[model samples]
Target: MSVPVLLVVEDDRALSAMLAELFEGEGYRVDTVYDGQQGMHRGLTGGYDAIIVDRGLPVMDGADLVALLRSKGVTTPALILTARGSVEDRVEGLDAGAQDYLLKPFEVPELLARVRALLRRIDNAATVVVAGPLRLDRVTRRVSGETPDRAEVELSEREAALLGTLMAAPKRVFSRAQLLASVFDGAESAGAVDLYVHYLRRKLGKQVIRTVHGTGYRFGME
Candidate 1:
């Protein structure tokens, strides 16, 4: 059985360590990245059960990344983190396609609850699912097509998180900040939404998400 893994994308060293400890205590294997580019790569390759992303990464900004991921067909559940937690900020994050958003300086209990909710959302089968040209299994973390038994696509925790997020929303847009809190917990993860979006596109395949042209993005559309 594959132990559920999680990827943490944050720049603050102290905060990242603290989050790592928290997740570890919660029985999740953790992978850490400092910048948006690194986070994107990890999200693309690391097979994690979930992803926690920040809004202010180094290589790429978080907003663009979220949009990118939705553009691809990766339906991972993502939580966005943002220091600027104003209504507009929150709207921006949601517009990019995040499942939820968390403001900075939050309590651990709420964080844990949010995590639980995200997992529940990810596992909600009665809920609608949206994907194109690929076979995907969330519980087994298996994605394949072609043979109806073989052709599979592997994804890291972050990628998986994004997949779940898109699956939950279908066609809504979520901005970078929303993705960070909903996905990464806003400690330092939301900043890389853009890079993650790019990573998602590469993995889920092209034309999965359509760009909003100067805004965020939308998934499962014509």
Candidate 2:
């Protein structure tokens, strides 16, 4: 599995570095930005597994940043950090779209625990995976484009499993052997990987999956 990517949008340089070190030590790929504007830019395109943002941020408020992300259909889990612990402040942050809130001067262990909880919740609740214009509903085994008039296409069991495996770790290249083991359970030959790739491309469009030459394939919706 690919390392989980995390975005830290904290203005304090020291704190950001500490967060980076902390999460990286825990096996996550961490990216840090010092302001809300940069946070918004990264949040929109980063494909991060989770985000940590300070409530008070420069250029744009962290709450506003989270709100904008939700408006754009970016459902990556978020945890808001703030010194403000008032009920109203907490409510505002939660209302804006953060899944969890942590006050400043928190214990490191508690912070880690909260982030783990957020990740677990997201993992359990993610029945639909959205990549750019395409939305894959795992429950229904169907894929659909964003346009209102676009029809949803049902996928075969193996096809859906293959697509879900790739979508789960977007941008990570998966070789035929890896895919065959994970999706085909080593029952199918490596060539079957290419055959199913053809099947998916035929149903979803040529751009649905990108071949990476000798490496393998990665999600291609971008």
Candidate 3:
């Protein structure tokens, strides 16, 4: 399974290093930047699952970077980290497109929880979704499905996410563009969606994902 990638934008050398180490220890891919200009450039170009930004940055400031990304339709979730703990500061950060705001002096567990929460929001699959004999566990990022030989199989993260999306609205056809926008986080292509559908079908039987003929795909038991 691919590790979830993160971009950390912080000017404090010690703090930035600490965060990168912490998140890496937590089984994530981390990229650290010392200033907002570099951060923004990386954030825009990189296929990051989420971003952690400090409010007071040297070149661009965290809020402006986040707001600019939002304006340009970069939907990757962002968390604001700063010493400014006022209510107004929190609101401003959120208003500028940061999903969550955390004060600098925060516990590691709380930060982990907030980051997980952001990921769940992006997944939009916090609850389990079921279709036929298939069950997808969002929390575990697992899919319980029977193979042709009647054995159960565990799916990868992307597979589970795609299956959950299809099961979320069962029998409803989803276009490639729509699936691309919802499922792929800029790291995958539209062809990848087709490939994943083929993968799911192979795992759960060809009847699992139905082709909608020139439109896209749908979920149903054959």
Candidate 4:
């Protein structure tokens, strides 16, 4: 399996570094960004297994960021970590779409435990899945279509993640909005999704992914 990716959104450089080290030490691939705007961009696009976001941030607040992600169906598990630890604050955090809330000056063990608990709930997705004759490797970001005699084609990071998302839930019929939220991170427009669909079709072959008319796209036909 590919190492799970985690996104940490904290403005404090020192704290971000510390958290990155903490999670990286625990066998997770960590990405750190300062401020809420950057966090929103990365969180939406990184395809992280989990996210740790600070409540108080410049550009955008943690609650707003999480709310936007949730509105767009970016359901990556999120944990709100901030110094605001009032009873109402926890309720607000949870209401904003965070899976867990951790106060500042927290014990590392407790934090780790909460993260693990969130991750544990996810069905471990495979690193590779076959869509028709196309073989996609999420870990290596490689897609092999056609036959062995054909050259193996490499996919861009976004392409690989997008393909992985589709193949992971074969025939699930992901709408363009759903694909934008889960695959594109809610940053890219729906047209971007269409463009990638074209790109994937050109490279992998048209039959690899199916368009369900006005509904959305699915991986291979039944």
Work out the TM-score per prediction. Answer: 0.56, 0.56, 0.55, 0.56
Against the true structure, candidate 1 reaches a TM-score of: 0.56
C-alpha RMSD (angstroms) for model 1: 10.4
RMSD score of candidate 4 (Å):
10.1
Separate clash counts for every candidate: 74, 0, 0, 1
Alpha-carbon RMSD to native, per candidate: 10.4, 13.6, 12.0, 10.1
lDDT on C-alpha atoms for all candidate structures? 0.65, 0.82, 0.78, 0.79
lDDT by residue (1-222, candidate 3, tens digit) is 778999999999999999999999999999999997788778878988999999999967687677655533466899999999889788777766688999989999999999988777654433565667777776676666655676556787777767766765564566776566556754777999999998888777888888899988877762
C-alpha root-mean-square deviation, candidate 3: 12.0
Off by over 4 Å in 3: 123-222
The global Cα lDDT (0 to 1) of model 4 is: 0.79
Question: Which tens-of-lDDT digit does each residue in 1-222 have in candidate 4?
Answer: 888899999999999999999999999999999988788778767899999999998977787677656544467889999999899888777766678999989999999999998787663433566655677777688887673348898888788777766765564566787678666767978998889988887877777688899899877733
Worst 10 residues of 1 by lDDT: 123-132
Q: Pick the candidate with the highest lDDT.
A: 2
| Cα lDDT of model 2 by residue, 1-222, tens digit | 888899999999999999999999999999999998799889979999899999999977787677656534468899999999999888878766689999999999999998888777644445776667787887788888842348889999888878876665555567787677557757979999999999998888877889999989887886
lDDT of 1: 0.65
Cα-based lDDT at residue 159, candidate 2: 89
Relative to the true structure, candidate 2 reaches a TM of: 0.56
